[model samples]
Target: MAGDVRAASMTARAFVEDYLLWTRGQRAPSRIAGASGDVRRELVALRLRPSRGTRRGRPQITELRTDLTSPTAGRATARVIDRVLGAQYTLRLDLARGTDGWEVTDVSA
Candidate 1:
């Protein structure tokens, strides 16, 4: 049970990291799940498409903390520092377990 919680936490953390990277144009959008339409549109609107010789390095996940309230629901917070942009950002995530696994139900920064 403890291990399951840990795995869910890790999964949520990785999901947030990958989603952020996608928003910043450093990652592709193939593997992510449970993203809202508005979020995707916003990312697309940013026009931050990655290109060769881009100025910013990939963003790094600094600190990720997860709270598993139950087997079905949890929350997480993460700190990401963008080396290229020279900025630090926080991500707050809400997760819910499903038949497939953990899914991000909501996220904010």
Candidate 2:
């Protein structure tokens, strides 16, 4: 069960990474245009496509801390510092144990 939770956390993290990459113009145009306001803003500012030759990947998730706000409510907030492109940012997640997986209801950076 713990492993499942961690895996879900990691998957959610990956989804965020994809969204960021799409925003930064590193991905295709269609994908880029799909981002919401927050993702688009980061993408425009991150300018990742210009710095794509760096060693580390984009928006690396460097730190993550979890808080169980209630017995059935949990959250994880992360600090993603992009060494090559993006500004120092924080990713917050309002997590809950769901029937299928950990559902991230809120995400912001």
Candidate with the greatest lDDT versus the true structure: 1
Candidate 1 regions exceeding 4 Å error are 33-55
Local distance difference test, each candidate: 0.73, 0.59
lDDT tens readout by residue for model 2, 1-109? 5665575566456556665566455564235321334544554565555444543456677777766666545677778887666568887766665565555655676
Candidate 1: worst-modelled 10 consecutive residues by lDDT: 31-40
Which one is best on TM-score? 1
Clashes of each: 0, 0
lDDT of 1 by residue, 1-109 (tens): 7876787777777788678667656675554555444455555566676665343567778898888888788888989888666789999988777787777777788
- What is the TM-score of candidate 2? 0.55
Range of the 10 consecutive residues with the lowest summed lDDT in candidate 2: 28-37
